[model samples]
Target: MSTQLSEDEIIQKISGNDLTIGSCASQALTYIGNKCGYDVRDFRGADSRWLFGQYTTSQKIAEAGGFVECDYNGFKIADRLLRNVEEGKEYFYTSGEHAAIIRKTGKKFEYLETQSKHIDENGFHPLTVNVLKKRFRTTKTRKLEGEKFLQKEVLIETSKISDSPNFKELLGYLNTDPKNQKREVPK
Candidate 1:
C-alpha cells in the first residue's frame, strides 16, 4: 500500500482521531511527512512526545525534501505559507511552544494541528503576532566563524535547553565569555 496520503486523508486523520496527548511538533511533522510521501516514524521514535525539539524536527523535515523557514514575524509566515502553497511544497511553522502544519486550498489558508485547544469550530487559529526587537543594539566586534554559523543560530533559537539534548551543548560552544578567554600575544 502507498504510504503517501492525500490532503483530505491527512485532514480526516487529524480531525477524526484524538491526539490530545502527544507533542504538537511530532504531530505536525508526522502529518507533513506523510502528506509528502515520507515516513515520519523513521525520524520520530515510538514515543512521539520525546521528539519535541523544533530544530531537530526542522532538520528531519529538510531531510525529507521539505523546506523550513524560521521567523518571528507573523506576516512573513503567512506570506511564506502562501508562497509554499503556490509552489506545491509542504511546510511547517513553529513558534514558542507550539507547532502546526499549514495548507492552502483555493487561495485560503488552513491549519492542521494536534492540540484540541488550538482548534475550534473554525479550525486552527493563527499564532499571535509579536514583533521581536533586539534588546541591545551594538555593532559586531568580530565576524562569526564556522561553516554552520547560520544553522547554529536557527538551532539555538528553536531548541530549548529542557526539550533539546543538544541545546545546552550547542549553547555552551557558542556562548563564550570574552573576559574568560585567553587573548593572543602580540609578536
Candidate 2:
C-alpha cells in the first residue's frame, strides 16, 4: 500500500488530472468531502441520511461542492446530514433578503428574496438541509462541547474546465467505457 497523501495535495492532483477513479480518486474525493464538512458515505448516499449540503448563495454552495458549480449545490444538500455537529442551530434556505452570513463553524447561510423556484406548502422554495443536520443534528449537549469546524473552500475548477475546450475532450476520455478501452492502469 502507498503512503497516504495530504488532502490538499490529493485535491491538487485530482484537479491536475493526475488522479482517476482508482484509489487516488477515492481518497481525494473522501478528503474533499471531509474538508467540505461532509462525510463521503453520506454525500454518496451510502449512509441512511442520504443527505447533501445546502447554502443560500450560489457562491457558498459552489464552494462546498468543490466549486464545480453544478445544479446540485453541496452546502445546502449536506445540511441535513451535518446539522448536529455544532449546536441545534442549522442553516435554512428561505425566500428572504440576505446575501450570506456565517451561521456556524464553517457553515454559512444565504437568504435570497427571489420567488420560489421550488414551491412548498408554506410558500417558500424547496430547500435542501443536509449540512445543518450532518454537522449539527443534535440538541444534545455532549456533541456541542469543543467541536472543530472547517471554513468552507471555494472551487473554481469547474469554471476553468467549462472555459477550456480541451476539458470536454479530457472528460470524454475519462468517462469513456473502460471495458471498450484497454484496462492497463493499476488494479
Candidate 3:
C-alpha cells in the first residue's frame, strides 16, 4: 500500500537524522521513494548490486545512490525557466552538480538545503529559492552550440501524480520550453 506523506509527516520522519555531505540527490530521492511502502529491501535498479546497495527507509538516505522510480526524464531547461515554476507543489531539480527540493507554497518558493552541516535535528534547512539560485549559480551559462542551451537537467516523479484528474494539464503547465514552450510527454 502506498501512503502519501503529508508535509508535517515528512518533516517528522526526517527530524531524527543529520544529512550527509554529497547526499542532496540521494536524500531527496529517499524522501520521495521511501513513501512507496517498501522497507528494508535491497535496490534492484540498474545500479551496481553490492551489499550496501539497499533502499533506505524514511529520512535515512543512502548518501550515494539515486534509486527512485521516475516516469519522465532526459530533458533540460534554460536558465530563465525558473520563472515558470508552478505553485502549491514540490519539485526536485538539479544542475548536474547539486540537487535540492523546491516547494511552492502560497506564492512563495522554499528549498530544503540538505547539503548544510548545520541542519541539526531538522535534517534540512528550508531557505528561499532566491538564495539557492544565487548560491548555486554557475560561473558560466551552459549553452549549446546554437540557441538551445541546456542549463539544468530536471526530473519529476510522475508516479506521485499519475492519479490526478488533471494529470495532462499539470504536465502541460510544467513545460520547460523557452520558445512556444511545449513538450508533449508524460509527467
Candidate 3 similarity to native, TM-score = 0.45
**What are the runs in model 1 whose C-alpha is more than 4 Å off?**
1-22, 32-46, 70-82, 87-90, 117-187
For 80-151, candidate 2 gives per-residue lDDT tens digits of 323422432222221111121122433443221111122221111222344233322312222226763333
Q: Candidates' lDDT values, in order?
A: 0.38, 0.27, 0.38
* Candidate 3 error regions (>4 Å): 1-6, 15-20, 35-79, 115-130, 133-137, 142-151, 155-187
Off by over 4 Å in 2: 1-127, 131-149, 155-160, 169-173, 178-187
Sort by TM-score, best first: 3, 1, 2
Model 1 per-residue lDDT tens digits across residues 31-138 = 544454543321222333344544575554343334455444434534453454542333455433345565445555545544333233223433323311121111
Regarding lDDT, does 1 or 2 come out ahead?
1
Name the candidate, 1 or 2, with the larger TM-score value.
1
What does candidate 2 score on TM?
A: 0.21
